[model samples]
Target chain A: MKLTILGCHSATPRINTHPTSQVLEIRNHIFLIDCGEGTQVQLRKNKVKFNRIKHIFISHLHGDHCFGLVGLISTFRLLTREADLHIYAPKGLKEVITMQMKLSDSWTNYKLIFHELTSRESELIFEDDKVEVYTIPLDHRIYTNGFLFKEKENERKLLLGNAEEAKINKAYFRKLKQGFDVINEEGELIKNDTVTKAGSAPKSYAFCSDTAYNESIVPIISNVDVLYHESTFLEKLSHLADKTKHATAKQAATIAKKANVKKLVLGHFSTRYDNITEFINEASEVFENVEVAEAGKTFEF
Target chain B: MKLTILGCHSATPRINTHPTSQVLEIRNHIFLIDCGEGTQVQLRKNKVKFNRIKHIFISHLHGDHCFGLVGLISTFRLLTREADLHIYAPKGLKEVITMQMKLSDSWTNYKLIFHELTSRESELIFEDDKVEVYTIPLDHRIYTNGFLFKEKENERKLLLGNAEEAKINKAYFRKLKQGFDVINEEGELIKNDTVTKAGSAPKSYAFCSDTAYNESIVPIISNVDVLYHESTFLEKLSHLADKTKHATAKQAATIAKKANVKKLVLGHFSTRYDNITEFINEASEVFENVEVAEAGKTFEF
Candidate 1:
């Protein structure tokens, strides 16, 4: 899986910094998360094919998070896209986007599907053959949700030489890979483990942002391979973070530590600090494995 | 008068090319026109002070023209702006902005006033002590209007040497500057022309964009000091311009010549063209003084 940070700053977009937006690629699916303003341009700059973005997930209705939805939808129409697009966001976003389209008289030629989220409890939101996505209800001023993407366990890898040595016929090879005992040509039962080995471990990632330091999400995102949490403020301005319903670096690190994530990525900086290295200094004090997110940075796992 | 092109391309913003947005400074007031996506970042890159922009004029409801408005307004609130902001746009825009703010619960601390426009003919929209703004109705796929900014006639310069020779008292200086005959110390009426020349001719600017080749606006923008017109295509693609309700470079120059504008600026070029100099070449064939608008380029009139 690969993740690209298109923007990580908070509040407002600056000349050199952008607001909240990221691209996650897993199992041939590219998901766009929280499309802030100028996100389409950022996508172009990062060399991500616009047509690959089939699903868009928005955390909330704040302008910094979802303001670019209308523009991206409009650009897709201008490019004459025919693929169906799905949006997973809060309930009010569909109304806002529909009103904008009606006023501009710019109806998309393709299908636009909106899966509005209103539930306050964690629930499965997206599922396919290879991956599953669930919503992690977050504590914020407005209705918000973080997404958890998990890859399904793969089939066992079959050893051809071992299966042949066991006198297994070609017709029973499929059953052996499925971790099933099968009868060979000589009417002898063969154990699946003798001819097969376990596949590589699956990967999981969790995205959380615009939320306060709440332990409720720690259980939901426990033991994920990678966790991206919002660190809008440092320890110096922890009070501001509390008042704004945002998380400080220390708070994010605490959540990461409690969740036991393999690696923690800190983002959504407030843009008030001159040096972002301070975030690493503060977060690493609480969590050993921590990294700060920057615009255009990529992480592969 | 100073004009800065924040974005000059059409359709959608790309890695380096932006959509439609510009800043016009006349008489001590800064007006933002056609705020496309990424306009706030463009403003920051151009070093435009945010507080100076008290009024924003939107040309239409197209995404490329007004998508950045909500983000800009939200940023103003985040910055704790205290000045009142006035927006003049089509009637539906107020509803859209209101709904966005309501959903986000980010009400501005400062007053946000909206002037909903639904007129089909030319009309005065804004007026202050030194500047007057009028809307020029245009033909497009949707409801659209261009703006005309006119500087009010300035006070005549008081010629100290000429006034002293005429034996005029300081008490009558204001009246003389107002172009009235003033009584001298010797009780003789001094003619206004002898002591004071006419103030520099009031500068005028007209902004027309996302419009087709329509001559009706010629009368509204006739003889302006500067005219910024949309040229989305060259002569080769003139048919596309007509079909899309846009204008070609030649067509823009034709209107500029017919209206006797002193300077014509062609902008909103289509991304299909690699060289923008072709716009200047095509427009200069019909108009003597023509320049193509580039992102971040400034023009002084």
Candidate 2:
């Protein structure tokens, strides 16, 4: 799985810094996450293919999180994109985007679908044969959800020499790969473990942002391969974070440590600070594997 | 009057070229015109003071023309702007913007006033003591208006030397500047034109965009100092212009020549043609003085 940070700063877009937006490529899906203002330009700057973005996941309806969505939709129409697009966001987003389209009298030639999310509990929002996505309910000033993308386990590998030694026919090879014992041509039952080994472990990634320090999400995101969380402030500004319902670097690190995630990526830094090294330094105090999410940087897991 | 082209390309924004947006400074007022997406970043790149803008004029409701408005409004709130903001746009813009604010639960601390325009004829939209703004109705796919900004005769520059030579009292100098003939202390009337000449010829600027080649606007924008007109295509694609309700470079030059404007500024070129020198060459063939609107380029009249 690969994740690209198109933008990570919080609140407002500035000359060199942008608001929250990212692109995640996993299992043949290029998913856009949290399209803030100027996201389309950021996507162009990052060299991400616009046509590859079929599914968009918005964490909330804040301007900095979802303002670029309507523009992206309109640009798609101008570009003559014909693929169906899906948006999974808060319930109010459908009304906002549809209203803009209606006012402009411009609608996409493609099938624009909206999956309005309102459930406050962890539920499967998207799934396919290769991947599954679930919502991680978050605490914020408004209703929000963090998405958890998990890759499904692959089929067990086949041991050619062991299968041939067992005299297993070609038809029985499929059952062996499925971890099932099958009768050979001689009517003798074969054990599945003797012929095939287990597949690689499934990997998962969790995205959390614009939320206060909440431990309830730990169980849902436990043991994920990577966790990207918002660290809007440093420990020195924890009081401001409390008031704004945002997370401090230390608070995000605490959540990562509690969830036992393999790696922690901190993002959504407030624009007030000229330097962000302190975020990593503060997060490292709680979790050893921590990295700051830099704009245009890509992470592979 | 100073005009800054923040962005002038047509259709959607790209890596280097942006959609339609500009800043016009007239009579101590900074007016934002047609704020497309990424305009705030463009303003920052151009080093424009965000707080100085008090009014915004949107020609139409197309995404490329006005998508950046809500983001700018939200940014103003984030920056804690306290001054009132006025937006002059088509009838449906208020509902669209207000609904987005309502959905995000983020309203501006500053008063956001909307002046919805629905008239089909040319009408005065804004006026102050030193400046007057009137809408020039244009033919487009949707309801659209071009703005004509005229400096109100500049208070007829006070010819101190002439006034003193005429033995005009200091208190009566105001009357002379107001173009009023005054009675001298000797009980003789002095003509106003004898002391003062016309102030700078009363410079006027007209902005016409996203419209087809229509001759009706000639009378409204006649004899203006500068005319900024949209030339979405070259003469080679004049057929496309007719079909899309846009103007060609040659057609824009025709309008400039017929209107008898001093300078013609052609902009909103389609991204298809990489080299824009042809647009200037084609326009200058009909109009003597022509300039192409470029991003980050400023024009003074």
Candidate 3:
């Protein structure tokens, strides 16, 4: 899986810095998350194929999070895109986007689907043969939801030489890869462990932002391969974080530590700071594997 | 009067090229016209003070014209702007903007006043003691209206030496500046022309965009100091211009010539062309004084 940080700054978009937005590639799907204003331009700058974004996930209704939705949708229509587009966002996004379309009288030629999410529980929102997506309800001033993408466990790998030496029939090869004992050509039981080995471990990623330092999400995102959490404030401004319902870098690191994520990616830095290296330095105090999410940067796992 | 081209390219916004948006500074008022996506960033890059933008004029409901409005409004709120903002746009913008604010639950603390226009005929939309703004209806895919900003004729300039030679009393100085003949202290009539010369010829700017080759606006914008018209295509693509309700460079120049404007500024060029100098060459064929509006370029009139 590959993740690209199209924008990671908070509150407002600047010349060099952008608001919150990212592209995630997993299971042959490109998912757009938190499309702030100028996201379409950022997508073009990052050389992301426009049509590959079939699914969009919005964390909240703040302008910094979802204001780019209408422009992207309009651009798609201008480009004459025919593929169906899906948006998973908090309730009321449909009303906002459709209203703009109605006012402009520019309806999309393709199917535009909206999957409004409002449940507070960690419910399964999307699933396919290779991956599953679940909602991580977050604590914020308004309705918000973070998404967790998990790759499904792969099929066990078959030891080709060992299977052939065991005189296993070709038809039983499938069963051996399924971690099940199968009958050999001599009608004798063939242990699956002797002919098969475990497959590579499944990977998972969780995205959380615009939320306060809450422990409720730790259980839901525990042991994920990578966790991207918002660090909108530094430790010096921790009080402001609490007042604004945002998390400090130290608080995000504490959450990552408690969740036991393999890697912690910090983002959503406030624009007040000229340098962002301090965010990583502060986060690393609690979480050993911590990195800052810079615009146009990509992480592969 | 000064005009700043924040973005002038046609169609969708790109990394270096932006959509339709500009700033007109007339009579100490900074008016934002046609705020396309990423306009706020452009404004910042141009070093335009955020507080000076008290009024915004949207040409139409097209995404390329007004998609950045919501984000600008939200940023104003985040910055705690206290001054009221006035928006003059085609009908239905208020509903579209208010709905987004309602959905996001991020209403602005300052008053957001909307003046929706629906009349096809030219009408005065804004006016003050120093300046007046009129809407010049244009032909387009939707209900679109271009704006005509005219600096009201200034008070006659005070010829201090001539006024003193005429023995005009201090109390009559105000009357002389108002272009009126006044009674001197000697009880003699002092001619206004002897006391004061005509003030700098009143300057006017006409913004016409996203319109077809319609001559109806020529009379409304006639004799203006500067006319900024959309030239979305060249002569070779004039057929596409007609189909898209846009104008070619030649057509824009023809309109400028017919209107008898002092200077013609061409903008809103389609992205298909890599060389913009050709547009200027094409337009110069019909009008002597023609220039292309480049992004981040400022024009003084």
Instruction: Please write out the lDDT profile of model 2 over residues B140-236, one tens digit for every residue.
Output: 9889999998888767777788878888888888888889999877778999988877677678999999899999999999999999999999988
Estimate TM-scores for all models: 0.98, 0.97, 0.97
Best by DockQ: 1
Output DockQ, candidate 3.
0.83
Q: Summarize candidate 1's per-residue lDDT along B1-301 as a digit string, tens digits.
A: 9999999999899988999999999998999998999999999999999999999999999999999999999999999999999999999999999999999999999999999999999999999889999999999999999999999998887888999999999999999999899999999999998999889989999999989999999999999999999999999998999899999999999999999999999999999999999999999999989999999999998
- Residue A51 displacement in candidate 3 (angstroms): 0.8
Worst 10 residues of 3 chain A by lDDT: A169-178
lDDT of 3: 0.93
Expressed as tens digits, the lDDT of each residue in A1-301 for candidate 3 is 9999999998888898899999999989999999999999999999999998999999999888988889999999989999999999998989888888988889999999999998999998888888899999999888999999999987799999998888998988887877899988888998888989998888999999989999999999999999999999998998899998999999999999999999999999999998999998998989999999999999999
lDDT of 1 at A222: 99
Q: Give the CA lDDT, 0 to 100, for residue A254 in model 2.
A: 98
- Candidate 1: list runs displaced more than 4 Å: none
> What ranking emerges by lDDT with the best candidate at the front?
1, 3, 2
Q: Tens digits of per-residue lDDT for model 1 on A1-301? A: 9999999999899988898999999999999999999999999999999898999999999988999889999999999999999999999999999999999999999999999999999999899988999999999999999999999997789999999999999998888877899998899999899999997789999999989999999999999999999999998898999899999999999999999999999999988887999999999999989999998999998
lDDT of 2 at B238: 87
